[model samples]
Target chain A: MTHILLRHRDIPDINTLNVYKKNGGFAAFKKAVTKMKPAEVTEVVKNSGLRGRGGAGFPTGMKWAFIDKNNWPHYVVANADESEPGTFKDREIMEGNPFQFLEGVAIASYAIGANAAYVYLRGEFWELAAFLDEKIAEMEEAGYLGEDLFGTDYSLKIYTHLGAGAYICGEETALLESLEGKRGQPRVRPPFPPSYGLYGKPTIVNNVETLTNVPLILANGADWYKSMGTVDSAGVKIFSLSGRVRKPGNYELPFGTTFRQLIYEYGMGIQEGRPVKAIMPAGASSSLIAVDDKVLDTPMDYAAVRTLGADLGSASVIVLDDTVSMDWVVNKTIHFFKHESCGKCTTCREGNYWMRNLTERIHSGKGTGADVDLLLNVAKQMQGKCLCALGEFSTMAVVTGIERFPQDFKQAVRSNS
Target chain B: MSLEKKYPKEVKQLLAKYPPEHKRSAVMPLLYLAQREEGYITREAMQDIARILEITETEVASIVGFYTLYHDKKEGKYRMQVCTDLPCALRGADEFLDNLCANLGIKVGETTEDGLVTLESVMCLAACDRAPMFQTQGPRRHQVSRVHDRGPHHGIGRGVEEE
Candidate 1:
């Protein structure tokens, strides 16, 4: 089937404004602005059953609806900080089908009554930021953006903002803080971004993939999108296939695609034809899934993956074959989280630091079984204490690795004892 | 020199992106502008940015301190950040980094004798599929490169020779 969100996969030069225009690009934004009310546009999304692709799986329309109507000017900040280890789908979307994504941003701005929007890209994407800035300028010149878009009083402008380098900034609140030129640490939740964000104004922060779905959902009817994916998780998703696979790249498949199909059919199986040992459905933040016949055949959806004790987060499948060890995997994830802890809440800052020390000692063969147990205990202690998901996510691989792959830890610690 | 005095037009354009009352939001971009010429943010530039944004220098310095991209001290002309995170490591990024370090005769986070490139291992660059990829951050430029079998030394040598 032709790609839906990843339209560039099917069409040539879809990144170009002219080519994108010819292929029914801005028609959705034009239709929404000319024919429908903002609430009506949002209603269509509400019925479509679209969820945020940014791991949390929150309902997209519900997030848009939560914007404080009493507040003077709602804002839309696109979370383009695609910093997750195995996730590279958003980068492809922004580079390949930029107009479609920008059009989605436009439609979302119209839906939430946000005249101004910001795309917060990670600092390493400086070139991508320039590329997107050019795209935003192109939209402005075409009169699709700027004051009085589509000859309607509804004006819209989209700007690209760059985060210096902080994984925690992917959190919406922390993203807002970074956009505001503050340290990229997450904020306390009670007042989420929808109620209080970006200079204390009500804002809608949607992931690039989530907002990219907006224009398509608007162009095609809600039922068209709902028909693609499973009931619980509707529509197609770009699975970022990476690590130990023959063909590791972005595979835009429907939500229900199995791991077996992704790794074998799309990704062409593991490297060297080695047997698959485990899978990290998410990136470093994933629980290490001990691969079995049931898991290999299980449908890859949020709810279904939850049955296997993991969220199909951003759907970045990192295949680990038999050659790899779980101890090393846990160590790598710990170091990542420790480096990116943001040091805001004591739990995440200290927890990751301590976990890193334990994982290092355990992985380097300098620790006994006591250290392995201590590492598991430290990780468990950090589970419910973090101010943000980063802290909670830090312990996932560690806890899962110890519990599921006890033999790996036993072997790792055996050498030292 | 102050950022406003050096590039008045660029400074104005950066501040224009944010509202006048909330122009403090322009600090990150301004920090980038200040670091454009030197590849590392200087004290004077931070002060200049702090003055322009109406925030304290500490506020600006705190930002430089917090984010990894904004370095406060001088280093090589170019910073080559390699991703050795989990996915990349799974695909031989760790070995790639080790080989690059061996080729350079300097460990990670050290500048070459020529002072052209400073190698550093970083977190994921979101290009997991492209294992052994590295991004170069120099004055006014940041470029990500996929360093396959030929080794990154040739690329680094070419980059140095170009300078």
Candidate 2:
């Protein structure tokens, strides 16, 4: 099938403004602003059943509809902080097919009545941000942005915001805080970004991939999008295939595509033809799924992956082969969480610090079986107590690794014993 | 030179990106500008940015300390951050980092005698597909710096891709 999100693969110059304009770019933003009512745009999206691609899988249109109409000067922030482990699809989309993603940002701004939008890119994407800044300038020069866009009262100005190396900033509330020049930490719930965000105004924070889907949804209509993917997942998703594969890259596949097909067909199987050991479907946050034939054949949709006791979060599938031990895998992940824990929340901050030592001991063959059990216990203790998902997610690999891959832990403990 | 005096145009553009009332939003970018030439954020840059944004110096420092990219201490001209996160490690990123350190005649976090390069083991950079992948965060350059991810014997890919 031809790629929708990754049209750059088919057309080389789609990144340029002239070629992008020729290939039906910004039409959706224009149509929504000049012709359609904002509610109508929301209605179309609601009917299409498009969900946020940033792990939560929340309905996109419903999120737009939730914007407080009483809230003045509504804001739209694009979550381009693609810091999640094993996820590189957004980076490719921004670099290869930027116009579409920017247009999606534009359309989203119009639908939510936001006059100003910001693309919160990661700091490491220095060149990419400069590229988008140029594109924004191009749109402004072409009269797509600025005062009186399309000769209508509706005007829009899009800006790019760079995030420093903090993974918590990827969270919507934390992203808003980061944009406000504060320490990137998650805020208390009950008033999400749509109600109180980016300086206490109603703001809609959508993932770059989620916003990238907007222009097409507006141009092609709801049915065209809903026609693709499974009933639950209503559009194509970019599966970031990586690890121990011959051809590791982003595969823009429909949600119903099988993990087996992604790793075997698209990724060309494990490196050196080694047998597949496990799969981290959601990067480090995933509960390690034992890669059996049955699991491989399962569809890669959100609901399908959920049945396997793991999420399809961001669809960043990190394939693991037999050469890697599960104990060492958890150790690496625990270390990452420890390094990244923002220290804002006790559960995450202390939990990760505590787990890191146990994992280090076990992996280094300096701990008893009791250490593995203690690590799992510490992870469970922090599960529901974390202020945000990062802490809770820190334990998924630990709990699941100990329960599922007892042999690996047993070997680590026995070596030291 | 301070950020304002050195790059006035860049400073204005950064300030213009956020609202006049909410100029504090530009702190991250301003910090980036401060680090652009110096390779590390200077004390004067922090104070200047804090003043420009109507924020406190400590506020700017907190942001600098929170994020990894904004360094307070001066370091090498090139900071080659390797992705030794789980996925990258699975594809021999750890071994790649080790070999690069050996080749450079330095440890993982140490700088070379010439202060040309400093290799670091960082968390996942979302480039998991490209194992042993890294991003250089010092001077700007057009060429792609190559650091091969294959085991010790593959030979170093090439010099730092970005200047």
What's the DockQ for every one of the candidates? Answer: 0.73, 0.64
TM-scores, all candidates, are 0.98, 0.97
| Runs off by more than 4 Å, candidate 1 | B140-155
Question: In model 2, which runs have C-alpha deviations exceeding 4 angstroms?
Answer: B140-158
What are the candidates' interface root-mean-square deviations? 1.6, 2.3
Which residue pairs come into collision in candidate 1?
none
Q: Chain A TM-score per candidate?
A: 0.99, 0.99
Local distance difference test values of all predictions, in order? 0.89, 0.87
Per-residue lDDT for A1-417 in model 2, tens only?
Answer: 788899999988999999998989888888898899999999998998899999899999999999999978899999999988899999899989999999998888989999999999877777788788898899899988899989899989999988888888888888899999899999989798889988999999999999899889889999999999998899899999888889999999988999999999999988899989899998888889988999999998899999999999999899888877888999999998898888998889889998999999999999998898899899989988998898888999999888888998999889665
Give the clashing residue pairs of candidate 2, or none. Answer: B144-B161, B145-B160, B145-B161
Candidate closest to the true structure, highest DockQ: 1
Residue A67 lDDT in candidate 2: 97
